[model samples]
Target: MYARDVRERVDAGRWPDVAAVPEASTARTAITRRVLRHALGRLPLLVRFPDGTRLGLGGPLVDVHDPVAFHRRIGRSGLIGFGESYLAGEWDAPDLVAALTVLASRAAELVPAPLQRLRGLWAPRHPEAQRGTPDGARENIGAHYDLSNELFALFLDETLTYSSAVFRSLPASWERMAPAQRHKIDRLLDLARVGAGTRVLEIGTGWGELALRAAARGAHVTSLTLSAEQRTLALERVAEAGLADRVSVELCDYREATGTYDAVLSVEMIEAVGAEFWPAYFEAVDARLAPGGRAALQAITMPHDRLRASRDTFTWIQKYVFPGGLIPSTQAIESVTASRTSLRLTRRDGYGAHYAETLRLWRERFTDRAAHVGALGFDATFRRLWTFYLAYSEAGFRSGYLDVQQYLFTKDAARTDGAPRETATSTTARDTTTAAAEGETAP
Candidate 1:
């Protein structure tokens, strides 16, 4: 019966159970159960079994329906197995974000020190095919961003912004999301000194929102993205706003991007660049910057120690959500810039709490529209996968395990061309001045 169900799911374009869960307990499974039992008992979380047994001291609740299967999965694959067990309905959480937050908060102490020293022996390494080479990058980008434009649209705001938004206040409402996203973009533009007649090069054009906003500032923009789906929609958006002449959206890789620009902008895209290519990525940015040009980047970051510990390990996020992605620590960013590029990190703003709120909004919206998502050809298992991904990310930020930052980099010296420094007032004025020209309201 279970095999028949799995076959049915596969035929319906759903997540298939490719690997069989161990049905019998082995010595390895027994050790896994004991280790997990000991670990959960120390955490301030409640792990309940169907037989009325429980673990942990009691906090957020995680109900294990098929405890044997859950233990077997974890015994086989560790964290990846934990996520797969969720997909396979072996366990569930009433408040997934809260449950995950509890775990994320104690991530560093989850395992014993002796076993921690042997992470390389137990953890999976990144696959060679998932490397961030030119061809690999295109394939990786397509795997996520090119999944379905409509699928993303269902969760993202009207602006179609995928990166974290800088909110003015906490407990951000849905109506404030789009404006907050625009504010985030304007802040980056202001940092990069974007204004009239500036030549802008944007990496990772996410549906052209940043490009449109830049072009609205009277800057000529060239935006590059590896996702062909993104390029198609971004070009349509550019044309729709009557800014086609000012904004050029190209389906190209960042390494292949040509020409130098006055300002360069990238948002939350560095995570996709593998650790091995960090130096090359920074070098590419350096090579494309004209003298005195500025570059602004919004990046999701983790602690330097955590990055070092997990940089080589393949986790659930790498396997199921974003293949070839690794969040860099701010220290890594600084070190790369110092060693590989002339660009200096001049200013940075951290808003990890805002990212927590942003993910909350997205998760709620995605949950509220689950039926619509299913109607769009996604099955229950796929929905569960994304739910886990979103909540897991929210928990990371909520627990302060992850953070997002906007960084400004200046080449050797400040602008020598006497371009007026951009201020909030100038940014708002530019928006107002160009709104009528573009036949649209200022973003």
Candidate 2:
């Protein structure tokens, strides 16, 4: 990851407005310096340069290989350029996770207020090609999930679950985390009450893990995914497990899916569905759900204001990882369902710390399997990019800047007495769910 050595190969390509600005360089650098100084003053991050000069409050130290390059990039492109600087190897931290955690802690206030307001000049718009139309869904999903089955198998557990795993304990070793994945699927099945005679519709089936688990409970499952790679492998996995008779894997979009199901479940797929299409996504689920049916989903959520502020901004994760992705705030979900759909959120269990540990295990596995990953055709720069992505995500959850929740929703049918199924003003007398010292499995 030498400075600018792999610029062409690593950069996804610059946005149209991201160009050289030699005339404004000094003014831009001044603004960058001021904002960086203000943000660092709130965190213990010491940024050191080649001249033996260092700045910022002292804690985890960051070594800037080229201060001019680093500052120039951020000055030109704001936060997206900040991530690009990492790929360009302009700076590195002794403890990347700790350093990033500090930054994420002050994420909302990082840029100076004046410049933050002018973000549209720098922030890239979400690409139209990555929008969530049926056709775009297939293309966008394939962009990341279809990287290669062999590639994913290199690091993912045998379960091949791409979503966050609900762990039985924190600090779980890389080799011992499969049970947690299984436990996660089992709990989701329980939440949706998949039974012997139930028909289940699974949206975003990742290698058929959840569908298989549901079939084991004797439910008939129809699983849909837009990725051709996932469907091919998932269909094979279902057969390999001798449950092909019970599970149907289709390379189909959720919007076009028909037939009512007794239960509907989606795990962390909402993030990939662009926020603008959220109402339609939920409506599709509602449409395919039978009368008195239950639906459960696992979603990653951010704070409401942050979601609102950053919803339209192009992000590094959206560009290099999950294209067109956006994490919704819990309030946003609640509001969408309350106003646009007949569904009511009845139960929620948040286990975000489990996701941090899950990412740790994955990062360790991915790094340990670097040789295998290289054989799968990913370059060193690609490896660095993914490593940073996973670590950056872990730090968000570890710092409580992110959360994952399993929600149970039901059709809001009126009772025989003509009252709503559940009142908004209901008493808060229900038992609270708690995580173990290590995040616990939901029961």
Strongest candidate by TM-score: 2
Q: Pick the lDDT winner.
A: 1
Q: lDDT, candidate 2, residue 213?
A: 90
Per-candidate Cα lDDT values, in order, are 0.84, 0.79
Cα error, candidate 1, residue 273 (Å) = 0.7
| Candidate 1 residue runs with Cα over 4 Å from true position | 1-19, 22-25, 413-443
Off by over 4 Å in 2: 1-24, 415-443
Candidate 1 lDDT for residue 271: 98
Report the lDDT tens digits of candidate 2 across residue range 1-443: 34545454453444222222123468879877777766766677888778887777788888888677778777766667777678767778868888888888788888767766877776778888889888888888999999999988888898998878776666677666778888888887877888897999999988889999999889999999988899999999899889988999988889889998999999999999999999888888878887678898989999998888788888888887898889998788877776667776767778888888888888878989988998888876778778889889998998888988887777655521222233332221121224422333333
lDDT of 1 at 416: 37
List the candidates' TM-scores in order: 0.90, 0.91
Candidate 2 global TM-score: 0.91
lDDT of 1: 0.84
Give me the overall lDDT of model 2.
0.79
* Per-model C-alpha RMSD: 6.6, 3.4
lDDT of 1 by residue, 25-124 (tens): 5887898889999999988899998789899999999988777788888877778888887877678899999999999998888877887799999887
